[model samples]
Target: MKVLVTGGSGFIATWIRHQLLARGHTVLVMDHQDRRGGLLDGEEFFLGDVRDATAVTEAAAHADGIIHLAAVLGTQETISNPRPSAETNIIGSLNVFEAATQYRIPTVYAGVGNHFMRLQGTGCYTITKSAAEDLARMYNAYRDGGQVAIVRPVNAYGPGQSVAAPYGTSKVRKVMPAFTCRALTGTPIEVYGDGTQVSDCVYVEDVARVFVAALEHTACHGAPAQPIEVGPATSCTVLDIARLVADTAAEMTGRAPVDITHLPMRPGEVPNAVVRADTSTLDVLGADHGADSFVPLADGIRNTVRYYAEHWLPGYQLQAA
Candidate 1:
């Protein structure tokens, strides 16, 4: 199968591309710019944005399927400047849906799974992603539209994640990178609120497998398909993840464990919510259900810690110097 991966340069998309190639499918990556590293060496790529209807249509042409991961994501980023992010998250998704319907190809959409959270978080990101997920479900119901398998992931983190990157957005506050970076440097790890909010963090590779499985399922099923939620069995609270990162970093890098500090929650954000994951949906969809089979939080953190220690820490030290 020849797959055209939108937002192919992203953290999850990078892993999805690798997974596709491992399965013997030809990958054609289309992103706004080239932020990828040697992980995708020698792969076919094109510079395109999903916001452009013509570009999306042309890219989907002659492709077996599309896993649409393109979006302006980040809770704070979307909350501060919601327009551009809304345009990309909502309008950009419309473009993908139109292209897939016109070409009659299967598609898989990446949803934020905000609705499953308590109060749905009420941020611009939650609003836009929820709207897009609704649109995807509606598109699947359209007689003329093709199947769009929706997979909502919770805190998808792994090696490809960066603290700052292609958009120059500071992802340091995100759970994985924030704790890992601070602990690696023996700095105080800050936890927002009372550290009671929980998240079902899923490994990126497992999330990629769910997307691939959805693509295959949607390809064979009829219209109006179901949206699968992928998450780990072990859901961790803010404090749990913080302490875990501190321990992992101290053990791996031979550094002292960092102290944890609690701060008031940021504006435009909610607290004391649990992000649930229905990995059983993976069993329903017949995908590789990750919670039981793939890397859990402890090992996932080790991998993430190791990745940042090698790649990000060196650059960070150079910058500090």
Candidate 2:
């Protein structure tokens, strides 16, 4: 099957494309940005934005399946400037859904974590994502031509995640990168609002596998995916993550143990928020999404730190030096 990955250059999308290629599936990449990630060969690339309906329709026409992942990410960034984010996340999703229906393509949606479990999320990104999820469900319920599956990934962190800029407009400030980068540079790791925010930090590889699995289920069974929910059984706080990154960096790079500084919580953040996905939901697809199957926080951190040391840290350090 030829799978069109909307956000082909993103961190998780890179892994997904590799997995698809490994499984002998043809990959079609469609993104506004050039292919900054993923394999260089064997990909039918389409340089386009998801916001354009015509672009999405043309791409979907050639795809047997679609994994919609293109969007403006980062909660705080979206909250600060919402018009563009809303346009991409909401309008972009609508275009994908419309295209799927038109072409009868089995589409997989990248949904958010358990952020909507407690309070109906209020942030611009959150609302837009939720609205998009609703569209997926609605389109599936109607079943005009195509079917859509949803994979709600929780706190995905790993290599290739961009480190946030202190001054410039960095798209996001991911914890894994921020902590690993600072620890490698022997700088104090900053935590937001006491670093007590609980998250189900799953490794990026595991999350990508989940996405691929759901897509396979939808494509093979020709049914809406079993609503896969992926997260860890144990929840790690923000401070816990910082400590893990710092400890791993110290062990791997022999960096002096860095301190964790608590900063005020950024806007659009909930300090008491917690996400523990019901991994059992994946049973419908016969995929092992059990709590123990996913990578542990400590092991994941070590891998992330090692990747940063080899792939990301040198350039950053050279710039700083």
Candidate 3:
């Protein structure tokens, strides 16, 4: 199968592209061409905007299916400038759907997640993604040959991901990088708002695998198509993650994570964003099942810290101690 992955240059999208190619499918990635780094091996990269119907149509013409992942994401970015968020998230989705129709593409899979659920304080981003998910549902019900599969992922973290990217956002940047950079130089880690707000962190590779599964599932091409959620469903509070990271770094580097217990929470942050996935729905769609497995928070953090220590610590814009 020839697949077009929108947002091909993104952290998760890059993994998705890699997975598709591993499965022996031809993959094409379409994005703004502004994101650094080139396409994954065995993938064709296109320079275009998702909001442009012509560009999307041309790029998706020869593809058998599409996994739409492009959008102006991240709450901090959206809350500050909602116009581009709407234009890219809402209107951009419309363009992908229209392009699929124009080219008679049979199976179009749409990616929708965290932002589609509760926004809490990030109304700007939540609003756009929620509307975009709704638009995908509309197309599934009304458009010709529309095989729209909506997959909502929780917080997906993994290697080769940049802190400056869209999903990482300024808010997440302040937290992850702040903690790791501090850990590197042996400084106290700041704890925001008692660090109790919970989050579900899924590995990006697993998220990408599910996407490929959705694309190949024949049951997803039917009427009243299924909308499935994927998650490890492991809820870890901010404090939990922080403690785990600190402990893991202590073990890995022979130095304890600094503990600074008083820090303010970011505005518009959710108290708890837990993901609930229906495994039965996935079975119904004939998706190959994988373990609802998750890496321990400490392990993930250790890996993340090791990455930043190698790449960012030497000369990045990370905050100085």
Candidate 4:
């Protein structure tokens, strides 16, 4: 199978590319950024944006399947700049769906789990993602042969996860990388709103596996596509993750445990919510489900801490200096 992965340079997309290549499928990565450190030796690369209809269509022409992963994520970033969020998440997604429809290729969309529950705040990220989900559904409805499978992933974290490029905007860091970085540098892990908000943190590799499975699943092609929720069955509080990162970093770096500091909850931040994995979709697809077998949080955090400590910490120190 030849697969084209949009946003293939991203943290999770990189792992998905690797998994696809390992399974003997030719992988083509299409992203706006340069393909400098993202691709493996055998994979092909296409430098383009998902927002461009011509670029996306041309790239989709050469692939058997598409895994659409490109989007402007992060609550603060999307809330601060809703225009680009809508353009990329909603309009860009339409481009992918259009391309898939034109070429009659199956597409796996990367949806967010937050949209499944009641939103706590007025974040445009969720709004745009929900709109994109609807767009995928519309494509699935009218297309004769092209199918679109939506996968709503919970909080995903693991090694190789880092802050996204600035892309002419503020660099917004995800919680795991931010906490691990702070802990490694002896800075306090900042928690918002009493640190009780819960999330299901699935490992990046597991999330990648789900994407690959969805891409290869034959069931999505002939029926109305359903959104597959992917994550661990267990939920962890923000405080739990913070303490775990602190302890793991201290143990690995031989430093003191970093303190967890409380800060005012950011606008649109959920105070207390639980995200659980729904494995029914995975069961139907015959994919390895995260709900039954997810990487233990401690093991995942330990590996992530080691990765930042070894690969990212030196560069960070140099930049700080």
Name the best candidate (by TM-score): 2
TM-score of candidate 3 to 2 decimals: 0.85
Worst 10 residues of 3 by lDDT: 165-174
- Backbone clashes for every candidate come to 0, 0, 2, 0
Tens-digit lDDT track of model 1 for 3-99: 8899888889988988888877788898998654443643677678889999999999858899999988777777778898788889999999899
Model 4 worst lDDT window (10 residues): 162-171
Q: 1-321 in candidate 3: lDDT tens per residue? A: 888888888778888888898989898888898543576667777789988888888888868888888877666667777798799888888888787766666444444445544445455667877787778778777877665667776666766666643323343363565666565666776776766666656667778887787777743444226666656646666677667666666666677666756676665565554444554555544535443454555566777878876776665544433
Q: Distance (Å) between predicted and true CA of 4, model 2? A: 0.4
Which regions of candidate 2 deviate over 4 angstroms?
36-39, 117-121, 167-169, 223-226, 287-289
lDDT tens per residue, model 4, 1-321: 899999988888989988898878899999998885656877889999988999999999999889999999878877788898889999999999999889888888999988855256548888888889988888777767658888888888998776543211227668888888889989998888798888768889889888887788743444235788887767788899999999999998888999999999887676676666676766756635546676888899999999889988898788768
Clashing pairs in 4: none
How accurate locally is residue 76 in candidate 1, as Cα lDDT from 0 to 100?
Answer: 73
Note the Cα lDDT for every prediction shown: 0.80, 0.81, 0.68, 0.82
TM-score to native of every candidate shown:
0.92, 0.93, 0.85, 0.92
Instruction: Tell me the spans in candidate 3 whose CA falls farther than 4 Å from its real position.
Output: 34-37, 106-112, 115-121, 164-178, 218-224, 272-281, 285-291, 294-296, 317-321
Backbone collision tally, model 4: 0
